[model samples]
Target: MEHTGPDAHPWLVALEQSGLGVAMRQSLLLYPAVEILHIFGFVLLVGSIVGFDLRMLGLAARLPVAPFARHAVPLAMLGFCLAAPMGLLLFATEATSIAANTAFRFKLTCIAIGLLNAAAFHLGPWRSLLQRGEVTMAAKLGAVVSLLAWSGAIIGGRLIAYL
Candidate 1:
């Protein structure tokens, strides 16, 4: 089905018509390259976050949390820098269809939740916990939630093809 009509978001429609988007959709090799980059980016992003979460859950109690965050957070941000633009390009390829997709919506929601959980951790208990060099129950809980949310987003992203 073709995307048209007032129901479709104007920005999405414009994106779908953009030169980059057209190339992404029409060029077989370019599409696959973008997909590969997207996968690699998310792998980096999720892997870094999971490692930090594991630490917060007491898997590496001997390691200091602040130093670890210094490394992990930057890696995660780097992954995001790689993944996000690729993801947006992929979406532009089939904007209207993806916008209407249940899995896509769920994935976005999960990402939002995951980001909020991270923000809550950083703004609240994390500040104090980092200073004192102790892991608190709240930190552990946030870690668990981060794991779940990011995992759900991955699952949802994968399911986008099938569902």
Candidate 2:
């Protein structure tokens, strides 16, 4: 697909021409290193989230939900910290093309849905359930949704290379 000219936003042009973007595209070692870091970050992020969701699904029923969240939430947030900037840098390296990619768009949509689902859980049933130390149908449903959304996001991200 055509990615440049008037179709490309000014910000995307600037990003493509920026020093970091140029370096990321041009430097063999840097690009691979960045990709590796991105992989690690997402691995941590998704792994932690899925693990936590499994816990909510009764994998470790003996463990208190609140305490599990205390550990899991921070780990997931740390993974986000690691992943998000690296992902942005990777995007900046090929902004226009990635922007036009169907898989990329789907991946972003899944991420948004996943985040919204998480927020709804925390804001709604999860808070009270955590306090009460009881799992509910709603909580389990949220866990299922979280697992599906994140898994879909990961799948979409992987498909970016082929699609």
Best by lDDT: 1
Task: Report, for every candidate in turn, its global Cα lDDT versus the true structure.
Answer: 0.90, 0.87
lDDT of 2 at 74: 86
The number of residue pairs in model 1 that clash at the backbone is 0
Candidate 1 residue-wise lDDT, 85-130, digit = tens: 9999899888877887899999999899999999999998699797
Which residue pairs clash in candidate 2? Answer: none
TM for every model, in the order presented, reads 0.93, 0.93
All candidates: CA RMSD in angstroms?
Answer: 1.4, 1.5
What TM-score quantifies how close candidate 1 is to the native fold? 0.93
lDDT of 2 by residue, 46-127 (tens): 9989988998899988987887888888888888788888999988887877888899999999889889988999997787
Off by over 4 Å in 1: 1-6
Per-candidate count of clashing residue pairs (backbone under 3 Å)? 0, 0
Q: In model 2, where do residues sit more than 4 Å from their true spots?
A: none
